[model samples]
Target: MSSSPAKPTSQHTSDHFRFHRPLAHLSGPFGNDSFALRAEAFARFFGTPLFLGAQTLIVVLWVGCNMAGLVHFDLYPFILLNLAFSLQSAYAAPLILLAQTRQAARDKAHADADAQHREALAVANETRLAAAALNSQQMLTLLQQNTELTEMTRQLTERIERLTVEMHERFVIHGSAP
Candidate 1:
């Protein structure tokens, strides 16, 4: 443990320590141990081109030295070299597996997030469609109400015109020049 506190990463969640996904160690439920992180980093480094090239160079030099009688170590059979390969494999396999497991977990998390996003988008679209339907209904009702109001206004105007004519007739009957 260092004097400083661990910083949280975006991918970290409340349950991050339960699973090792992307950035869980960077910022998660549990603070990462520096030594463990360093060891994992070192284990991952074995897969690089630099490591492969260096290993090849060492093997070639070892074989050449043994073949030329300059070095008698593991002569002809190269049992020591074979043992080194076996040892490397034993350690490398587990480290590689650890990295793979971590990567798989990270991929699963991304997939889950994508699924959640898609679901949320679908829900939003559904909500928008529902709102549109309600708006359409409201618009239809308003239009019907407007049509009814217009018809009532026309009927009222006709009735007023009939009344005025009746009043004019009554005034004529009384010999008024209206």
Candidate 2:
């Protein structure tokens, strides 16, 4: 009697269905990886081949002007081009770094927010449980008190009846003697 192995259960099947429902419109297209997004932004801004081509064209134009004697021996165009490229690099590097830092901070903030939400939910659930327990205890105490009061009332009534009968017998016997 050999038994077949059980199939493995899907990990996120419920979550997938929950998000894919018609009314669930809160799903996002992006995953958790922000580094890839940041890298793509950096590439779009600074790593395009077109920028290199433009730089090369500028250099060529400066060289051509210098060679044709149309410019001075100081090579001012070349100096300016180099200065612009240097400045662009300086600023672009810092901007990219800043973007990455901001992304990290944003991710951290999201994680912190999720943690806080979970903590709040846990506290709410605990409060509900505590309240339910307190209500149950109070109900039990009230029931016990009601039972004790009922018993005490029954005992007092019985004692009053016994005393009344004894007083009536004593009064009747005294009246008959008179």
Candidate 3:
């Protein structure tokens, strides 16, 4: 089998990230916050399979140990487990909301940047179209002028031919009479 060489790309194709340059200052949400960043990460971890599986395994072990009489830390009611879940929920709810709010802000910035880029492209397209239209109009006017000059040259050539023929006839007739 024969292999084909790679096709060359234009400069426009290489500028895919040009639209994102303006959003550089708005990186990682509206502003930088070490605590908020950590909390966001923690909140994100709460929804992952790894955290869920680990939590489930721990709860199972706790119940198994208590039921088997291996430990007397909590009775069958499992009030301690309930309190732990409540505490986790108390922290998780606010952190998740914080993460969501930051994400929404970042999304808005990106959308605005995209809108600006699109507007710039539209303006450029209009400029190019206007220039093309003007060039076309100028070319048509030049063509008209060239056609008029050609017609004038043809008329002058015909006049010169007629004058030459009349002069030749006069010279032949007058010379013969003499």
What TM-score goes with each of the models?
A: 0.71, 0.40, 0.79
Which model scores highest in TM-score? 3
Better of 1 and 2 by lDDT: 1
lDDT of 2 at 61: 80
Backbone clash count for every predicted candidate, in the order shown: 0, 0, 0
Q: Which stretches of candidate 1 lie over 4 Å from their true place?
A: 1-31, 172-178
Better of 1 and 3 by lDDT: 3
Candidate 1 residue pairs in clash (backbone atoms < 3 Å): none
Per-residue lDDT tens digits for candidate 3, residues 53-165, read 99999999999999999999986999998999999999999877877787887789899888888899999999999999999999999999999999999999999999988
lDDT of 2 by residue, 42-97 (tens): 54567678878987897788788887889865374467667777988886887667
Error of 2 at 25 (Å): 30
What's the C-alpha lDDT at position 61 in model 1? 97
lDDT of 2 at 106: 58
Model 3 stretches astray by more than 4 angstroms: 1-13, 30-36, 171-178
Candidate 3 local Cα displacement, residue 72, angstroms: 2.3
Candidate 3 colliding pairs: none
